[model samples]
Target: MSDDCIFCKIIAGQIPAKIEYQDDDILVFHDITPQAPLHLLIIPKKHITNLNEIRTENADIISKIFTQIPKLAFQFEISEKGYRVVNNCGKDGGQTVFHLHFHMLGGRHLEWPPG
Candidate 1:
């Protein structure tokens, strides 16, 4: 994990967060700065800078993350209406956090081609 990564601190319990789900491989929690009515972040425990850095060995772990999204959505009661999952890759993509994470947005209608 990166020494200064906020997410790593959250995972290590060095910082506090409103966690929704967690397991051996991942952790799901509410965004401290929510962009939507139901904005949450799903992140892998192992620190990877971004999607571009994901290795072949992490393929299964990546699949596991996607597999868990639906279940997490259900737990948050947003499965019926729908939700948007986003991964910001780099600086140009608006990635503020260095650690890779997926943003799950729902609980209301969302416009396409997000700004």
Candidate 2:
């Protein structure tokens, strides 16, 4: 884990978060600054700089994260209405944190051309 990464800190128990789920490889939690009524952040326990850094060895963990998404949406009751899963790649993608993570948003109608 990256010493300075906020998500890593949270995973390490150094920081507190409204964690929704956790396992040996993944961590799921509510977003501090939510864009929708239901906004959750899903991340890997392993420190990955960004999507561009995903390697063949990371496939299993990545698959687990994606498989857990729908369950999370259903658990939060956002599945029927639909949801959005987002990954910001770099600074230009509006990613403030470098650790790889996905934003799950729902509970409202999402418009096209997200900024």
Candidate 3:
């Protein structure tokens, strides 16, 4: 884990967050700045920088994260309504943090071609 990674800090329990769920592989927490009514971040325990950095060996780990999103949304009461899972890749992709993570947004109608 990178020493400067915020998600790493959150997973390590160094930086506090409104934790929603956690397991051996990932940590789910409420976004400090909510976009939708249910704006949560699904973070991998193993740091992978960003989408551009994802390697073939990381496929299983990434798949596991995708598999957990549905359950996590349901757990947070956003399943029946629906949700959007997003990952900003790089600077052009609007990725502020370098860590690989997915945003689960729901509880409202997300506009087409979100920014």
Name the runs in model 1 displaced over 4 angstroms: none
How do the residues 19-114 of candidate 2 rate in per-residue lDDT, one tens digit apiece? 999999999999999999999999999999999988898878889999999999889898898999999999999999999999999999999999
Clashing pairs in 2: none
Off by over 4 Å in 2: none
Q: Report residue 94 deviation for candidate 3 (angstroms).
A: 0.3
Q: What is the C-alpha lDDT of each candidate?
A: 0.91, 0.94, 0.89
Q: What is candidate 1's CA lDDT for residue 103?
A: 96
Looking at model 3, report the run of 10 residues with the lowest lDDT sum: 52-61
Q: What's model 1's TM-score? A: 0.95
After the best TM-score superposition of candidate 3, give how far the Cα of residue 37 lies from its true spot, in angstroms: 0.8
Q: If both were scored by TM-score, which would come out higher, candidate 2 or candidate 3?
A: 2
Kindly list the per-residue Cα lDDT of model 1 for residues 67-106, writing each as its tens digit. 9999988987999999999999999999999998999999
- What TM-score number comes out for model 2? 0.97
Best-performing candidate as measured by TM-score: 2
| Top model number, lDDT | 2
Q: What are the clashing pairs of model 1?
A: none
Name the regions of candidate 3 deviating beyond 4 angstroms.
Answer: none
